[model samples]
Target chain A: MSPSIMTKGAIDCDIHPSVPNIEALLPYFNDHWRDTISQRGVHDLQTIAYPKNAPLTARPDWRPKLGMPAADANTISTQALDTFQTSIAICNCLYGVQLLMSEDLAAAFASAVNDWMIAELLNKDPRLRASIVIPTQNSEMAVAEIERVASDPRFVSILMLVMDEKPLGRRSYWPIYAAAQRHNMPICVHAGSAYKHPVTSVGWPSYYAEDYASQAPAFHNMVSSFICEGVFSEYPDLKVVLAESGFSWLPAHLWRLTKFWRGLRAEIPWVDRTPTEIARDHIRLTLQPVDAPPTSEQLERLMDHMGSDEMIIFSTDYPHWQFDGVDVIPDGISKELATKIMVENPKNTYPRLQ
Target chain B: MNIQLMDRVATDQKIKLAIADCDIHPAPKSVPVEIYPYLSKRWQDYMETYGIIYRQGFPTGPAFPKGQPNAARRDAYPPGGGKPGSDLDFMRSQHLDANNVQLGILNPLSCGQGVQNQDFSAVYCNAVNHWQIAEWTSKESRLKASLMVPYEDPSASVKEIDLWGGDSNFAQILLLSRTAEPLGQRKYWPIFEAACRANLPVAVHAFGYGGAPVTGGGWPSFYIEEMVGHAENTQSLLTSMVFEGVFERFPTLKLILVEAGFAWLPALSWRLDKLWNRMRAEIPHVTRPPSELIRQHVWLTTQPMEEPEPREHLLDTIEWIGWEKLLFATDYPHWDFDEPSRALPIRVGKEQKEAFFLKNALELYNLN
Candidate 1:
């Protein structure tokens, strides 16, 4: 499998491949399940192909515009390897494990999507690397899927959406992180459609703008829960990347959490290192929504705080609205930071790419 | 002015010497109805529909209608909203003589942006609140203020309120309007509890927009749409307090509503009286008509006054809502700020005017 023309010079950190057609993927899901993929119009690939010229299918009166167009496997791989000039492409999602394991049958969907994704994407191209999706809805299945895919050279990391129902740092999720640690795979937590539960314990919000802004607090809680839960302390080798999430809120979040930890340090005594130390040692963040785009002042501030370029990773979140581009990166940041985010940091995190 | 001291003594029997000006505002630069000539055009038709006829420099007649040029910026405060009588500097210029006003409450026009933008729209809100507090409130002790919390999320609102509620200059927890359910609704309880714990008074100031409409009508495209939500928010807030049992639960809690004219109290009590007799089974938890609880726990500011009715009706409106619960404010810089010296008399006699102007406000704000 040769590197395609799209992988011309740099590595592509974020790419999406549509899972086998939505209908075809349905039978592979477990029984006692509802078929929401088709009902939700998740497989409108043709309309996505030529968005500006495409005719509007869903009535404006019935629904708000479904945000971003879905991308198929071929479209994803070609863009990453050829158009982006990447030596390696990290395919973050085909079908997340939570969706495929619709009912009580988690093991079946976990194994099925794993096999289907590899055959359709990985086996076809060596330049492409994928995250092994584990069935987060079912614990045993989640561990089993990671173990089965652990030995695959084409697999790079373990992927899951940030869920509010259980903090990723809880004992319930330690096994998944432990498995990633054993396999030398980093953990990638990406943003998803709103959670099945209210994103907060509170009731629903009144508008879409409310929904987007709420993501920051939930993200803060999940990270703190991870820290206080001792997920980082227990698995020192595990590297965590908050994927496709904006990074601007980082300064305030770190400040608040660190400030609170001062008075409440007794409860989480196992966390011997300071929160900032833990963040620098085991965590990396991908810049999207370009929360704090690089400018002379912003770059200076971020560099001063995070201390190294390795803490930042460049991600386009391609096929998603609000994608950050190379041009948006501020000119004042040293080329060294750009090289690390654009090339070195990603390569080092997922050794399969290296 | 002498009656103000007598009534303050009558309400609580506690006597104190400190003088507090409960409502004082450093108004912003006015949007010259001429500079953005379009504002006058857009707002004019709505003004006329409400029967507002204009004086050359000011909107002279009617409670809500009519156009008027607000006073030019006097020597002290800068050219902004508010007529000469209502400007902050005007109050300061007379501060030594007017009840020796020791502290003035500072409320800014820009603080209304959250309600104007759908509350939790962006990080811009956090930045906006930060700038307002850091820049404006730093120098003035007279400006004991309230921090505006974006109401989109109860958690963010709680977080911010708890974070800044401790600032010495911040006096109250400001929310755009009351929640949809009564105050006891658990969803809103977090904000109440946070405010209670901080010992900060929770205030609901009516804004010109953003609420479920009173009638089945969608939001009107014209600015006239504002009139719809003003009273609607007041009624929702009153229902939340009484039926939601907020007063019963947090007896020590203080809630104030500003810019919501106080004239509606008597009529609302009558309506509540009819509803409680007819609908007790529907809201049995409310041991009394909603008005009984409102008069005990709620306070409203007086601005946008109606013409002089009989002294008895004026006394009836205040007595029905509890005279101790009325606060006087010159809604400085808003389109409707009435001069304290003028708006005060048209509604009540000299003695009652003194109570509304200084005594009630001082007690409500906990200023001696």
Candidate 2:
């Protein structure tokens, strides 16, 4: 295998710190929630969003003989931080917090998850940062959770699922964006769903592969909603990161959007700038699951089409095996582009890192 | 946007590219009464009383509100203010003759393929097929028609193919990407079988009023969502066709995906090949990698052409998808039509321009 591309000060933007089970979260949870969980027999609320045993979920070499993959900070540090020589890594916990029905319980669990990260991961690793998971079931509770976590500098952004109960750009979710913008936190829209709606507009997909591939369209819809609903215009300072969502589709989407927007501009006059300009200013995507052609030339061509180098940030997508070891950066990019994706772009995107 | 149009018009006046427009919708001048002669008396009465009972619960019109009347360009409407694509003289003056189109392939999407009543759908498809040749293709020698089939009933679909499959005017068989099931399933095999037997390529377009949402998840909220949803639906169809061994079973079948963007093709092919490599045991019938089958059998129409940023990325995508596989389509009279002159990136070489604009489609349809 090739040596790790991680230079000394590389920023690993996406590293999952797995919550092994609900019981591990009980200590951080309040007594009422603890009782509620016990009463409901909520043993292991581990989400099927990323199947625990799926090969893609954990690389063969990274899999632990004793416990779940990346279950603790030590596993993460060894497999991600040390291996990649990461100076700073962001922990994005993708649990079933959004899947919970009760708004109160969901909020409490989200808060508990964030607290557990601080104690078990963030505080232990000073180089680590975390995204605040919010209960999207209720926007008010979500904003409250954001407010609760805003004071902590360790929390860098708010993590969200791509396919939520409603389009994230709806005014109902504006309060969360408002709070994130107020605190200068970027929103990371991860490639997963709350399962409140079918992943596609038609209905449920039959296979895991279909479900996985469908995330691209979900991202496409989310981006459209955000742009058309004037989310970026409303919260101009906010930067939205599309985590684990592939980047290949962006250029075409932007092109089509710009074309349609020109014809449909009279209806949505609020969108004063071109769709491409708006998206370039606001949207950023990770590079680990860089869904480009498997050629260096093609990759370079894609970057050229992206119009700016600043839109992509370096990520390992650690423990979620998107690429082979040390090939975390896809082929086709030059050393200069690689450095931009690894260090310069992430630093530019996340003001907190500065 | 206005400036872009003005610039395009100026460029269009100068550039006289003889192109084969692959996708042109020919709507009835009024309600589809022209097809009544082709339909049985019972079906004609059924149409009069109940109208078309589409599988979808939503209204028969497009899911999203159109930006233009009938979702057509304002200039495309006839002098009498009837639906665009209704008046051939107007279409000739406005689009066909104006653009110097060598041949235009008609894809009639308004036909009742999504109707709940199977017999009505079959009759409607048959009527439209005959109507296309009678009203459009025969009237204009430069125009060619696609043979419509009642895809839900494969036997009826076969019957329709048998009727017009040998006709010179009918160039290919038309199927929608969104059908009762993925087009690759065993149930839809007969349609493919008939098409292959008739030596006709299957042209699968994006829109279908199938009860199911365009995407597998459910109905999308916005017009843009529904519009962009075409890519996902086409992806699912391609996956189903490839994984289900449809390509292997009917190696002679040729597929033309219209109104779907081709930029996603390279990534999709890579992802599928990767997955197929790992999950080969699940589908033993697929003899070759999915990409090989796609390159061999599939052709994508360029209507909503992928405009990659740096612009050259469009060239890269075309290179990956293979220049030979792209068929230039205008999606005429629609709001999102691509003018032939400005459709492709300026960076495309003369040979590639020739292939994309005219030659590739000519060879595919055997127009030569």
Q: CA lDDT of each candidate? A: 0.54, 0.82
Score chain A of each prediction against the true chain A by TM-score and list the results.
Answer: 0.80, 0.97
Q: Find the 10 residues in a row with the least total lDDT in model 2 chain A.
A: A200-209
Summarize candidate 1's per-residue lDDT along A175-232 as a digit string, tens digits: 8888888888888876653145443222234322223333443455556666776888
Lowest lDDT 10-residue stretch of candidate 1 chain B: B214-223
DockQ for each numbered candidate: 0.01, 0.32
Error in Å for residue B72 of model 1: 50
List native contact recovery per candidate, as a fraction of 1.
Answer: 0.00, 0.22
Clashes of 2: 11
Clashes of 1: 22
Candidate 2 positional error at B65, Å:
1.0
Worst 10 residues of 2 chain B by lDDT: B1-10
DockQ score for model 1: 0.01
Q: What would the per-residue lDDT of candidate 1 be over residues B170-221, giving only the tens digit for each residue?
A: 7777765533333345567777778888888877776522333221112212
